[model samples]
Target chain A: MIEFIPSAFAATFSVSVLLALAAGTFAGIIIGALPGLGTVLGLVMALPFTYVMDPATAIALLLSIYVSSIYGGSISAILINVPGTPQSAASVFDGYPMAQRGDGALALGYATVGSFIGGIFSLIVLVLIAPQLAKFALQFGPIETFALIVFALTTIAWVSSGEMLKGLLSATIGLFLALIGPDAMTGQIRFNFDSLFLSAGLTVIPLLIGFFAVSEILYQAAVLKDVKLPAVTSGGFKLAPWSEWKPRIMVILRSCGIGSFIGVLPGTGATAAVFVSYADAKRRSPNPEDFGKGEPSGLLASEASNNAVSGGAMVPMMALGIPGDGGTVVLMGALTIHNVIPGVRLFSQQPDLVTLIFVLLFLSNILMLFIGGFGANLFSRMLRIPTTLLMPLVFMMSVVGAYAIRSNPVDLFVVVIFGVVGFLLRLNRFPPAPIIIGFVLGAPLEMSLRQGLILTDMNFLAFFASPIALILFCITGLIILNLFGLGNAISKRFRRKETQSNN
Target chain B: MQQKNADMLYGAVLAGMACAMFAHTFSPIYQNEFLFGDVSTVFFPRVLLGIIFVLSMMLVVKGKLSTSDAILTQINVKRVLLTGGATLITVVGVWYLGYLVMMPVGVFLIGLALGYPNLVILGITSLISPLVVWVILAKFAQVSFAPGTLL
Candidate 1:
């Protein structure tokens, strides 16, 4: 992998790849700055273009968008009092306050600089941790793999939605959707309703387009009121003086660490990281009372932590073939289209490509820093584009994206159907990310389970024989128990007994 | 509607679908014949449907036991339905009339349905954006757009 760095650089510096990096970064900033469109939708819209690009260019494009979009969210958070993406939700606590105080440029500066540092910090963590994680995963047999997938899916569901039951239901629905096409083991189709198109199974791209993009369109239509656009605070590049930043350096670094750590945990994403980091920053600050009231540290903590999650989230996706969030799930889907299967073997089989991904990510963060700074005003202006006007373009893009993948007309229907279903499910408060995660992981989960069962002579008990699998199963059981509040009950009982014994 | 009722309704509907899917797993379409202890193709799907059914029931029970006074988001039903209808028509239109033809109409109709107040902007964007996209994707990237049979 170390030796492959030179080639990775050579590959990345190509005209096409560089162009993709610049374009993707620019488009990502605009998309992220917009209120409705976020990282997942940005990736979905970029998917069709990737179909025509080579593997290197495609990876560059997607990686740039993924990194920059997370950073882009802070622009809106600063100017419009609305976080462009959920990951930036915490930014509004301080970002908007700063803008209201006529310090929008300085707030954007903190966000941009903090995001850059966070990104680079996470990239370092990714480079160090991913290959090692991949190496450890390579030792996992079918049973361990099965256990890991279950744990990942369970954790994702638990964290993704407010209602754990709804999240679980959404995940189950996604798993079922994955089973609709041909069975991987037997090549026999199931639940396709005898349609010629049903046998082939649902493609991730169309499903993604439907669920994220199209569903968003519908969801917007349902909720969007005919109102004037909110006034946007002025935005420009203004670096906070060194004196202003000196005291807040620790906060930025700590938030980045928190974000990177949380990102490494499957299913816990930037949204969780930002809030946690913000709380930590406030708690640790000497002037905690100043926090969240136009405090630069709070804005930095939110922006940095969320941006750091970008690199952190990719670790699981690139190493273990597990997506940590919706953005990574979409990124995983894009990688698959280019025949770049991300898993344990990815490290050994294509170290060069892995190196290339790392390099692309690094470059994307750098580009995000420059592009975000120079283009702040442009993105701020973009926030004025009404959802009414933009969503229609998004719909058109969704149409093109769905149809362009394999040029199958049936995919158009899949996008529409999933879009409506996604919108309806969202209205009912079911988290869409878990569904996409479950769908992406579904086939592999089933395959690993069946293989493990076969290896164990069809004895389900034997699945726990492996120490790794046993630990994973135990952790999963604990998570499920916690979800049901049984873990708390049991803990309370133990505490009561301990108190009695102490008395 | 109350959040509880919405949950209950959604849960019941999902449970019904799960049950139907579970029954389909037992259909003759699934070759029940086991080969060297390999499970049938229906095995995994059955397991999934079973999980779905259980979860759906849990949702219904949770809904029943709920005390929260939360209400579901108020949807603009007419706008949603009209937008959905427009989307369907646009997709179907693309299939019949081709990308170049239906895409602009689709974009325009979707914009109209979404209540974009500025008709001129909507019309220009609907017409020009598709052509720009077509030129880039079809000409530069070599993507093959849908050429309608009618055209």
Candidate 2:
């Protein structure tokens, strides 16, 4: 693979980075304020505009949007129980209660502070660690790439967030979707059935709009309840003072660390990051029960880690060309489209662009302070938008967005069909995330596996015998055991028998 | 809301999927002389599906479904159908009336269906929804969206 890295850091300054940051964050906030709108949709929808811009400027704008959207979701979750994005699921635990308790302003402030701290920490590491990882990743051949994807896929089953069956089922559905296109080995189409749309399987934009956007619109509207924001939250806004916040240092650092780890792991997404971070913060805190009851520390841990995860996910993607999270997959795709082939060699080849990316990453995280702190409360009123009007808009937007992907009627149709399928799956309590991941990763994985086999003469023994694959297989096996309640059973036995003594 | 313990449909669907997948595997493996690539590609995912199929069937047979974390017990079919139907209409309608007419019209109608009935609010909702998206998506981050039938 040819790697294209621009010359040394174009002698860029904080000014350009700041401008890009301001522009992107502002845009992200606006988009995020609209229910069912999100970072992925924001970034992907913005791709065409980048066609004419400098690579740095383009990357900066997109990265800023990525950073701010994580914070944007917090605005809604805190003011309204509805989480705008799945990652912000954690924010609702304490954020909503805080708002209800008349601490909406204070809760928003903490969320902003927590987001900034997390973003800044992850940015520093992204600059330092990404290049190192990239250099190492350049050494990988198709074998490693194939193995990496397999590992990512297997990880999803584990990340079913304590529900492996649901995860596997969703993943199976995804793989099935991926198989709809032509077979990689024989170049034969599987399920086209006289339609041109099936020839390309399904595009990401429409499906994303359908599952995440359209479905979300319907779901949110159905649950719509009219609740007023703090009649006036501005007067109540408080930072809680950093000196007083020092007790949360452990929570902040630990959550950031864990959040970054979660972000770097694919399929673990923000929702998982939020729950685990919240639980960990509570588990480690001096007062664990205070969580989910409007504790600022709970918000701190949840917000920081979740935001940090936004940046941290890029670490794996830039280094190994592996998508660290769903957002990074979009990022990696954006990079490739700009013809910036990922996987290591770019760090040495284009120090300038790399530096630009670093600066942009930093700028985006910092910009969140401005976006989340001042803009958040003002935007929080989106919760007040009646679902009746909101639902139709989301549906239309999904259709338009899906059709926009290829401008093909076929894609639009697929989006609608998937909308119904997605709705059906959701009704049945089937998680849609895994299936999306599956379809997204399936084709590439199948192609890679076949290519590897073709290279290795169809050796079935090759996959397991490889040390990395062996490790991945073993980990997947352990995850299965954990999901089967073996881990829970073991841990449960060790706990004191409070139930027996209660009587 | 308690999770509906009904697994009959879920189990049946999975079983059908498994049969199709297994049939695909069998056709290619036995009928074709050249099944290159590792057999695991064939065996692995299928075995995985077989396992899934069995698990789903067991769940269905036992009727042991659980909805542990869901806040809403049972989904309203009327709500789903109305929403889904309205979206389908808007999507299909756009190809004919164009994005502008269809979106506003769709938003207005669906809004009414969902019980939002201020024409002023509905009109503003339709206009601003796409417009706001336009500014953020096109002007800021720079991606193209559907030009639809309308500008």
Candidate 3:
């Protein structure tokens, strides 16, 4: 696989791939800087173009957009207090303050450098860990796989929505949606209401466009009160002296580690990582009072950790075929369109493609650093583009994207239907990501469970006999116990009993 | 509406839907041939529907006992309906009128519905953006677009 690096580089340096990298980076930055069009929507809009692209070029484009879009969010965060993406929500704490004080260029410098380091750190983690994880996954039989999917879904649901019950309900709904098409093992169509279109099953792309893009448009329409653009802070790029950055080196490294670790976990995404890293950075800072007042360390921790998540989130998606967040879900969907199925088999079967992905991610980060620095002012200017104007364009792209895939007019309706469904669900405080995760993992979960059951000759309890499956199920049980507050209650009772005994 | 009331209502609706779906799983369309002994085609879906039913019931219980005073966000129902209606019309328009002919109109209509202030800019962008996109996607990328039957 190491030998494939040279070939990967040769492939990446091709005119077509390089063009894709540049265009993806440029478009991603603008999309990110503009509030309301974040990484998922950026990828959704880019999906139609990928229909004609070769796999390599398509992956290059998506990878660049994914990496750069995360970085692009800081532009809006710094220039205006509005975060362009949810992942960058923490960036505004210190970034906007710095810009308010006319150090916007220096702030941009810190964010760009921190994002680069974080990206590189995560890429290294990805390169080292993904293959090893994939190798470990090869040992999993159907029982273990079922256990793993259940655990992953549980963890995802627990963290996605604030309310555990709502999250679980959302996930269950998603699972039901996946079951609507047909049963894979028995060739029996279960929930299709006798329509011809119902038998073929739903495709991920249209579902994605509906849930992430069209639903967003409807949500925005419902909530948007002000069409006026926020005032932009001055933006430029100026690298801070080494003396200024030297003290923050530890903060950057700590944030990179935090982001990478959190990113590797299923369902917890960069948003979680950034806030956690920010709090940790503040806790350890000597000048904690200055933390939110244009503190470079705070900015560094927020920016670095969020960007680092770009690499960390891919680990589960690439290694286990489990998406960590909406961005990766869209990425996974795109990869499937190109017939590049991600999972335990992907590492062994297509080492070359994996190597190319690594190279592409590495190049994307590098491109982000250069492009982010040079294009800071331009991105700040783009913040003036109102959501009112941008959303119509998104809607158009949604229509085109849905129709372009398989050329089915029914898919257009799928986009509209899911769009409304997604919007309604969101209005009711149901988190959308778990639904997608549930949908994606639904088929595999059913297959693995049935297969495991067959292997055990209908002895359901035999699933627990596998040590790996047992451990996974135990963890899931603990999570469920915690969700119900039983874990905490039991621990508190035990502690009280211990105190009484000591007395 | 209060958050609790909304949740209870949503849960009841979902529970009802789940019950309907669960019953439908036993319909003859499923072909209930059990090649794997106990596992039939409807087996997994039944399990899922059952989970949904239980979860929704729990949601209703939780909502009934909830003490929080949080209210649901004030939604502009008229705007949501208008925007959704505009989107559906756009899709239907594209179906009959073709991508090249109806897309610009769709974009313009959506923009107007979303309350874009600058009509001139909206008109220009709505007209030109789709044309540019079509040119690039259709001509350069060799992707096909629906030509309107009416056109």
Candidate 3 residue spans exceeding 4 A from truth = A491-503, B36-38
Computed on C-alphas against the true complex, the DockQ of each candidate is 0.81, 0.39, 0.76
Local accuracy by lDDT, each model: 0.91, 0.68, 0.91
User: Model 1, range A348-465, lDDT digits (tens) per residue?
Assistant: 8999999999999999999999999998888898899888988989998898888888888878999999999999999999999889989998899999989988888999999999
Q: What are the runs in model 2 whose C-alpha is more than 4 Å off? A: A1-20, A30-58, A80-86, A89-104, A139-144, A221-242, A279-295, A324-326, A330-355, A381-383, A483-503, B1-5, B21-72, B127-151
* Total clashes in model 2, counting residue pairs 3 or more apart in sequence or in different chains: 10
Model 3 Cα lDDT, one tens digit per residue, A32-56: 8899999999999999999999999
lDDT of 1 at B24: 79
Worst 10 residues of 2 chain A by lDDT: A1-10
Q: Is candidate 1 or candidate 3 better by DockQ?
A: 1
- Model 2: per-residue Cα lDDT over A1-503, one tens digit each: 11222332333344654566687888776566555667766665555445446666668878988888887777777776767677788888888889888888888888888988898888767776787777766666556667776677667666765556666677777776677656666655555555776765665556655665566656654554432332323212468877759898989988888888778787777777888889988888888787889888888888898888876788776776666455776676567656786656677676667766776676677677876676665576545555466567556656655665466666666777776677666665666666666766776677766676777787756767667666766776777677567888877875646555675
Query: Model 1, range B58-131, lDDT digits (tens) per residue?
Result: 88888999999899999999999999999999999998899999999999999999999888988999899999
**Residue pairs with backbone overlap in model 3:** B97-B148
Query: How much is the TM-score of the A chain of model 2?
Result: 0.82
Model 2 residue pairs with clashes? A5-A350, A8-A352, A9-A352, A45-B143, A46-B142, A46-B143, A47-B143, A49-B142, A134-A344, A174-A439
